[model samples]
Target: MRQIKIDYRRPNPVPQPAPRPAPAPNQGRPPVRGGGTEHPGKTRRCNRHPGVHMVLAGYNTEWNTVRYLCPMCHAMGLPPVEVATGVINAYFPEKGYGFIENGGPRIFFHLSDLATRFTPQLGMPVTCRVEANDKGLIGREVTPR
Candidate 1:
């Protein structure tokens, strides 16, 4: 013979507060006009340096983003030259050696010379800043296109 006891108790339902009435429309203040129309309360600023009013130096169509020269970044008298474009002819990731097709003698580059956020790939279109030395043109700041 076996005796078993079963206990059954229903759980209580949670109480919910009554729904709030809808707020009256037009409670917010009207926007004041001073800055550009694109952003009502916001003003145009340097993309690199916040709080710096950007000056219209030029348009960069390739990047599709406006270029801004901050006083702290472009304090030098001379502006940087345009970046040169070429296909990466070869790249040895293990050895950190690479070449670009710049229509001149084989342009040599090292992994350290590439942009910090960029990784060079063989046959990838890239833009670089070049400097000439006795050996040949050395590519620096290599970035993919």
Candidate 2:
């Protein structure tokens, strides 16, 4: 007999992010450029498509793989922060895969129709724009919205 050791959950689909509700009339505020506080009388951005916003939520670490991880910096407890703010990474019109190059490291992103223009170029100039509503960084944009 033989046995295989591998991540059992890898085969399953990545969990989707919580959805954002559409803003009601006079129930929303202006969109913020970078991270900021939500004004008392402000709503989020105008999401043509609201609900079920998913992000490439993963992190990296310098911990030793061979050794057991310490309580600190293990799992989602220490979610990695980005090094750069807004930067484009990749784009594919056909496959529909684009990425925003945050400061810390590269991050994977899924763009809709408008983002298809900014395909992932190896070394092209891309403005990695991160879309944030009431929620943190829900969606990413290679180009401006």
Best by TM-score: 1
TM-score of each: 0.44, 0.28
Could you tally the backbone clashes for each prediction?
A: 0, 13
Candidate 2 C-alpha lDDT tens digits along 21-121:
66566644443322211112222321332432223223323210011122233343543222223335566757765555444335555656234564455
TM-score, cand. 1? 0.44
RMSD of 1: 20.5
Model 1 misplaced regions, further than 4 Å: 1-82
Worst 10-residue lDDT window for candidate 2 reads: 62-71
Model 2, clash count?
13
For 55-137, candidate 1 gives per-residue lDDT tens digits of 44543444222233456557755343223456799989889889987444567889888776767787776656566678877
